[model samples]
Target chain A: MEQGQTMRGADAVIKVLAAHGTTTVFGYPGGAIMPIYDALYGSEVDHLLSRHEQGAAFAALGYARASGKTGVCFATSGPGATNLVTSLADALLDSIPVVAITGQVASAVVGTDAFQEIDVLGMSLAVTKHSFMVRSIDELVPTLYKAFEVAASGRPGPVLVDIPKDIQLAEMQYQTPLQALETPVVETISNLEQAKQLIRASKAPILYVGGGVGMAGAVEQLRDFAKQTGMPSVATLKGLGAMDKENPLYLGLLGMHGSKAGNLAVQASDLLLVVGARFDDRVTGRLDSFASKAKVVHLDIDAAELGKLRAPDVAITEDLREVLPALSMTLDIEPWKAEVAALKAEHEFNYNHPGSLVFAPRMLRTLADKLPEDSVVSCDVGQHQMWVAQHMWFRRPEDHLSSSGLGTMGFGLPSGIGAQVARPDAKVVVVSGDGSIMMNIQELTTIKRRKLPVKILLLDNQKLGMVKQWQHLFFEERFSETDLSDNPDFVTLASAFDIPGKQISTAEEVEPALDEMLNSEGPYFLHVAIDDAFNVWPLVPPGASNSDMIETLEKE
Target chain B: MMIHALELELHQRPEVLERILRVARHRGFKIIKMNMRSTSDVDATMELEVDSERTVDLLSNQLTKLVDVTQCRVLSSTQTAQTASL
Candidate 1:
């Protein structure tokens, strides 16, 4: 057989991936996976050589999250595949699309002790959305195709495809899948009569939107539903950018460190129409008190979340893509829109007013204004992260990426790199807290090495701000071990990595600092110092109802 | 076929690693790959894999005084297995 005509398994894998527009792959080469890497030499797909297998997985995660595409990562078996477990689990929990392919031991050495051998399939079962072990080399193309389809569709998450070493070397003819991949449809319980009854009976109706709204690509439907129902909608951190923040109905993010107006609106609401969001702890401060007066109706794709927490009065376990359209058709909410406008006139989420200084919230809100439409914002997990979710509004789908599930601290920088790589034309911004940035500060080298055009805004409070807030509120003011005044300057550190860095303190410097970083031609960092003693307000004491949020220390 | 508990503390430097393996070498032991942690940080934990049971006894008498190891012991994995059998 001619080398060019014969469809080798390695080349077939690339072709299948390329068909899905998987132009980029993150991986490291190893002895066991030499055949795949060797075949990749002539392919057009851009393969990023990651420093480690775990980094590759995380980078893939970042890419998928930013682009809403199935991210791919390749690794050799044994230790290489094992290293991907943590990142895989992270992606799985967050519903991020990741497809991990690992080259396993040779077919002859199956179940026998061989060099660089591992049971990759058995190890990844608990973490992945789906997993497969390829024995027949002929099945590789179909399996890879299936993996991408499963990963990208319906509650997207990481999937694993473990192929033995011999499978890569084996030749096969490429036969394209006959039909489009069919994903299982989750049905919504559209109790139209009940929905009408709930809408009619309620005095104050509010929409609690979540991350699934973006995943469903139902923003327009949600906007129309909001216009019809006249409900002031609040998004969870995961659902931050699903609706326009400037919209009158949009009430910003609801959770701990959430907007004061959003938190209060939920407390006052009589009917909560939750769309595509689980009532996570951050959203439901005091779980019992969350939307205390409201008759809750939750619409979600995952059935497990329907009655999970803050149990919904009418749970619709279906995609918001389908449910929102139904809501718009079943009822006319024009009169309710006036009532929602009336409610908005009474309550506001944006804490900023004229002459207000550039506080973290205002800074984020300004950045949101500065960001081009469809710009993706990735944030590290902290008080700053919550502020971004609440205050930094987004205008496009999947425009906001954060490790909401794992709540990993040092996720912003590398994730920003991944996001930028995924969509180089779309501007990427990473809003990271000082404490969170230090966890994987070494990744600064990775960003510099790639010369990715990513903008990083470091919120410098010089404290583990979240922990200290809890300490002040619950631990009798004893802020044990969560302060950071002694650490080296991050701006100075950024310079060492050859990335241009700036330090800004006053409000006068913030805009100029932002302008400088934005125009710096490549990767840049802006560090802004705010007061360490500043506490994130509207905190609900653990185990308290969400409505029972203790606003400021004086409220106690 | 007796299950033994083995504990190997990987050193940062290769020469230090060479020096530390003497205790294992003098007593004669082979490690199993499945039950070990090899970190990218260069320091990791290793289990005996096969016959991890008498590993502590072999290292305890002459090796405790060997100058660099901070701590070594018969960990709870051995005890847990024994309890499981009972």
Candidate 2:
């Protein structure tokens, strides 16, 4: 390549991705996006073809979440682009850094109801952090750079770049644009002093952690703060691995399906040192009664989140890495710690079931204990998701990838594929339910194609367990379309994709089957049949305070 | 209903107005009146009068997050305003 060489816009798109160190992208090719796919043909950048565009985008999200790098995905116009909306929205809510490139119709035919053309930029406005429709070839390179920047910048989220067919075909001179350096925002000393004063003055202060800690790479600082303050802590669903789970004072997850000890501690706390977390409705059951006695000291990178739901006594919208270290101080509150410990002991999870049928929670706990240090658990939504959150422990926030904000059903398999692609040597596992596995089950072929050593643990209740539970409790047992009793034989289905699997229903087979799944060289699915009578316990009924959680209706 | 007036400076783009209005509507602020003029080829200024029971900071804070919005400020806010008879 010469200094002033002209290349196709599509070629420049691939070049820009390589320039940003994007080694692998997940996407599906189509009519409008064929040019970019053509450019990706022999380039250094590799593309993993997904069965569906939605799967491709979710895989990109999993890659980004796993590696802390901006994930890239590609799609064509109309249906291809529409399929990406849910994943993009998921990324936006969870604040994952992803850049989705969609190929639009030719510029002249954009608004004339052209074939395979939809208003992608217009459609993207609600789902993405920012979006661009390249009107000319000259703006192609710069727009790609900007897209990457916006995706990875402050409070990162997904960004979309819609390129018209004409722009991809046009030739343009290749030149690297000057990059702009972003100035970091520094916290004020006065705000730090004010927050410290609140922490020092309180006798029952607790640390409320969220996903932002890992997103900001401030997990170490947060751990230090928790250690120094000696404060009991409760984590949101996304905040699970930010704090060391081994810490006695760390009372696992807090919120809807949270531990009784965790929710009670929050309700009784006098001060909440909220770090990198929002007061989401799910976390704050009835906003007026949630932490009714606690004064909040909120810290996050996004200003809008500071006072979005619960107004803070001291709001610091600076990087958590700086703020957490600055506010670390030894506290003189031992009585509160003892009380929280008592609560934890009083409400510990019981694993004593009389039946011979396999127990999902107990099985998940066993699976967690057997997982190696270098393992990632990607789970789908519903009863299995909550069970994983309750039973499994993670080494870091990246080690546990669940669609926290969106709670999308078909997230586990594709995300597991992306995680395996990102960390080739890691023991990546997908924990999905009978209802969720079928959503993106086509990706089993992806694992076979790559021969990736990813493991699948499918818990089969033969029904949409979560929905059926809700129907029993709230809707008078008028179960509406939640049954999945006729589910296909999962082992046979996996075998069709050249992946070996086994099905087990007895409690006696749990341990050996888990060991078999974990030790297998290639992909293996372990489908365990469980009773639908089991439901996620300790649920904070809708519109009720977190402290008013329904313990359980039917005893196992 | 409460009436609030806001002043905003935005980057000149084809869809900047749509972005601002969409955010305002989504955040529970209704645009009652709006005036806009180009400050330059690349910049535009808008004065928006909105009606909402929610506080002005809620709308201003969200509006400030938009990439196209350069600056957003609350000009005035008044409670006890009657609903517009449009």
Candidate 3:
């Protein structure tokens, strides 16, 4: 290829993707994007055809999250682009880097209500970090490059580029633009000293870790800080695997439906070192009383997040990799550690259930213990999601993928497909509920088409368990539109996709069924049926302080 | 409600103003009066008077983060501004 050699803008799109090292993309084809699909027909870059546009974008999100690379997805105009909004919003809230390219109606007919055309740029502005409508062939290449850069840069997020059909067919000279140099991070010595002084002065300091540690690639630095200070720690939902689960001083997760020990310890702490995590409403129930006594030291990469919800005693918007190491120092907090340990011991989860019914929490714990060293668990939202977060543990932040910020229900199956594609050899499992699995249930064919050796664990309670639980407690037991007693036979459903599966309802069958699922060579589904009587315990009633958590129905 | 005036410098993009106003409105600040002028072909400046009970940083911090916003400053805040008389 010569420097000034010309090619279709569609061809330039694929070339730019290759230049950026995008090996695979997830998408579906429709009317407006045919030209780009034609260009991708025989290219070296592989494309996984998802059943729906939402699935495509979610798979891209899964791929990006698992590999720490920018995930790319494509969709056609109007309906196709509209279907992608949910996943894009998911990526935006969770801060995953995804580049979505949508084909628009030809520029000439764009404003005249052309077929399959809508105001995509206007719709995207609310969901994406930034968006562009490429009006000409000259802007196409530069916009694509900028989309990739913006998606992966500071506080990574999804970026959308809408290219008109005419531009895709028009010829353009392909030239790689010069890369922009990154600005250096400057850390002030005064801020570091003030943070150190706060840490030194506190009698009980706890590290409230979040997803930023993993996003910054600063887990090791955070761990070193924890080890040096001998501080007790707790993790947010997205921050589950950021700390070593084996650390005696690390409380599991702190929030609604959080471990009682974790919530109580946070309430008792004198100083909170909030790292890479916003004080989300879920994480901080009754904001006015959350960690009421703790003096805060907040550190994150985003300057806007520093004082957004909870103002800090010392706010440092520097790289966590640099700041964590600078702030690490030995401390004497033996009594605090002992207190946290006692809380852990007192409120430890009891796997003992009275009947032969299969306990989902214990089953998840067993699965977590049995998982291989290289495994990723993509969980959907609901009761099963909470149980997975509570019972399962991961080796790294990337290993556990959940729709933390958006709490999207259909996230598990497609994200699992993407994770499996990203890590071919790593065992990827999708933990979905009866309600959540139906949201993206069409993805089963995607697994069969690609022969991805992914595993599915469907926890079935025949109800929208989370909402039903809320209704049971808060709405006088009016379980309106929450019952799903007509759920299809899950094992037979798996067989329809040429996937082997087994249904287990009793405690006696749990272990053997799990073994069979794990041992299968191809995709396998294990559907576990449990009674809907159980609910997520230790819930802090909405707007209640963390200290006011209700342990069970009797306690409430 | 308190009244605050904001000064902003932005890169000249077709939808740049929409981006700024969207953030301001979403963050609970209502723009009561506004003015804009082209500083150059590639740059533009805007003056905005907004009314909100929330702290101005809540809006200014978010406005500063938009990709097209080059600069943002709070000019003044007043407590006695009448909402209906504006």
TM-score of chain A, every prediction, order shown: 0.89, 0.98, 0.98
| Residue runs of model 3 more than 4 Å from their true location after superposition | A182-190, A554-556, B81-86
Lowest lDDT sum, 10 consecutive residues, model 1 chain A, at A348-357
Comparing 2 and 3 on DockQ, the stronger one: 2
Docking class of 3: medium
Candidate 1 residue A326 Cα shift, in angstroms, is 2.4
Model 1 lDDT tens row, A1-556: 1224466778777887788899789888887788889888978888877767877887798898888888999999899999888788888778888999998888899789788888787677557776777878768888888898778776788989888888888988777765574556646446755876786777778889888888888888888787766667888777777777667767676777665667777788788988888788867876777777889887877755667566677877566766776766334455655665665676545555344244777777778878877578888988888778766677765788888877887777767777888998878888999898887677777777788878889998889989887887789989899988886788889889888888887776777778787767888888898876556666767786665656667432
Q: Give a tens-digit lDDT track for model 3, residues A301-356.
A: 88889888998999988888899999999998889989999999999999997789
Fnat of each prediction, in sequence: 0.00, 0.54, 0.46
Stretches of candidate 2 exceeding 4 Å from the true structure: A1-3, A182-190, B83-86
- Docking category of candidate 2: medium
Count: clashes, candidate 1: 10
Each model's lDDT comes to 0.74, 0.92, 0.92
TM-score of 2: 0.98
Report the lDDT tens digits of candidate 2 across residue range A113-229. Answer: 999999998899889999998989989999999999989988899999999998999999998888876764574644888998999999999999999999999999989888888
Best by DockQ: 2
How do the residues B1-86 of candidate 3 rate in per-residue lDDT, one tens digit apiece?
79899999999888888898899889998899999999899999999999998889999988887888999999999995554443
Residue A501, model 1, lDDT: 84
